[model samples]
Target: MSSPSTLSPWRLSVAPMMDWTDRHCRYLHRLLTRHTLLYTEMVTTGALMHGSELRHLRFNAEEHPVALQLGGSEADELARAARMGERWGYDEINLNCGCPSERVQRGAFGACLMAEPQTVADGVKAMRDAVSIPVTVKHRIGIDKTESYEFVRDFVGTVADAGCEVFIVHARNAWLQGLSPKENREVPPLRYELAYRLKQDFPQLTVAVNGGITTNAQIAEHLRHVDGAMLGREAYHHPWLMTTWDETFFGDAPAQRSRDWVEDEMVRYMERAHAEDGCPWYAIARHMLGLRHGLRGARKWRQVWSDHRLKPLPPREVWAMAQAHVCNESDVLVA
Candidate 1:
């Protein structure tokens, strides 16, 4: 086992999804894929710089090889945030210029920055200069109706010149005016070919394609051309797909843990959460509901745990109900 920073360049990774890839979610994903790197939801540079350090930068050790994604345009602020991320053990620090949200636009960042590649290049260069760990960037192919393939090719070329080695290209155009954030992730037509061409043109830069990619087969196929693949909604909605990534991508032995066994692993997580003030088990458990998809009584498990009855229950009691679906009669009683 190589240290996280050393092993990261070799593996596939998941994207940092807003309201989706929190600490609990990252922990759940870790069980399914040991080697594939994970990312935190994009934390604004303002929040990271001005907000409580313990609140915004905290993460469990198990989520190693994880990268912290930051959204901001200021080179100094982004550099400061990158340093904080490194101090807190984040394996990588990424800049987000791809999100098409109005709020992001109001701040003078996100997809709109595609037109300001020079500014993004400065931000990337500043972060890279601030940290020895990998500093990367994720962006869209184009904004609004500007769908020229050369737009993204140029974006990659400019950013790479600033010393960014990894590029996560979401192969779609962001309609910065009409589409909402949720719509931006979906309504945009995914143009994977453009991303493939980017890899061809910028062979020295590691290019990874994101958006509309939902299956291992799709990831495998994309890998043939590009350096990596990143999953967002697909990875969230069907988490079990990640269970094979460790064996498939990293060549680790296939983990035979049943869904029940994975749930048991959550107990250690729960105990840690309980000890940490201001943290609750439900906050973490919500992300784990999709863990048992396609299993017998999986819906029941979701319903029961989500019930208000379990809200006030201690970690032990919550673990009891979560394990009920898999534990046999004697095992349940013993627990």
Candidate 2:
């Protein structure tokens, strides 16, 4: 069949979360796995046009191979926003067509764009023409009850013609009318085979599957069918899951780092962020509360870092408090 999929950067990645995949969150994830691509939160074209550019686009130099995910339907605006992403040093530009949130729909983008493939093609072509970096699309298999495979097939064919070589398929139908965004993620059944079929049909394109994949074994399975597998909340809540990705998926020698070391490194980043941006340490610390997931005393440790009272204290000091919970079993009396 097609050549093996592991050679591409899109082979493994974290989905672009809204408020959850901000720069600080990306920094923490980068520390866990180096090769896996990271995505910025979905920033609207309007925000880029009228809002603070630095606040929307600035990212750490360390977050390389990272993509800027844009939300909008207008061709000119998407092109301009994409140029800004390229100027800011982003490695790729991804157009979001899978989001089902009402707010995004009201803005005339997201999964609603799936209903208008030509508009998406226009945006993709504009962005592709505007920047040298790769332009990709993240979308659902279908919208509402349009379960016929032909619907998604045409969508891919049209966009692929416009120059998008990489597609991250969420593998579920987005019911735009009856469900909340949270419900959309849960109520829809995942049809990963549709994603596999897209890859089979367009062997020249890079196709990755995302949605309800919670474990590395699951990711490995999807990889067998498509070019890649992307984890969303699973990666965010249990980031340690990514620590093994370098060796397990990318064929690197075993990583020489540990969770404790990653936590220490994050503390240093916090100091620099606070000193430079005047950001509160707690703002950064909140992202790593899941760092200790499933481990002994994880709950208590999470409680320590997430405690608002600790905002007055430095990150290192808050770190010490969290460590105490992991170290001193007696602290279990209260989180």
- The local distance difference test score of each candidate is 0.84, 0.92
How many collisions per candidate?
0, 0
TM-score, every prediction: 0.93, 0.95
lDDT of the structure predicted as candidate 2: 0.92
**On residues 202-280, what C-alpha lDDT tens digit does candidate 2 reach at each position?**
9999999999999989999998899899999999998999998888888876678777888899999999999998999
Candidate 1: deviation at residue 77, Å? 0.9
Alpha-carbon shift of residue 26 in model 2 (angstroms): 0.5
Indicate the worst ten consecutive residues by lDDT in candidate 1: 326-335
| Predicted structure with the largest lDDT when compared to the true one | 2
Query: Could you report the Cα RMSD, in angstroms, for every candidate shown?
Result: 4.2, 3.1
Stretches off by above 4 angstroms in model 1 are: 1-10, 322-335
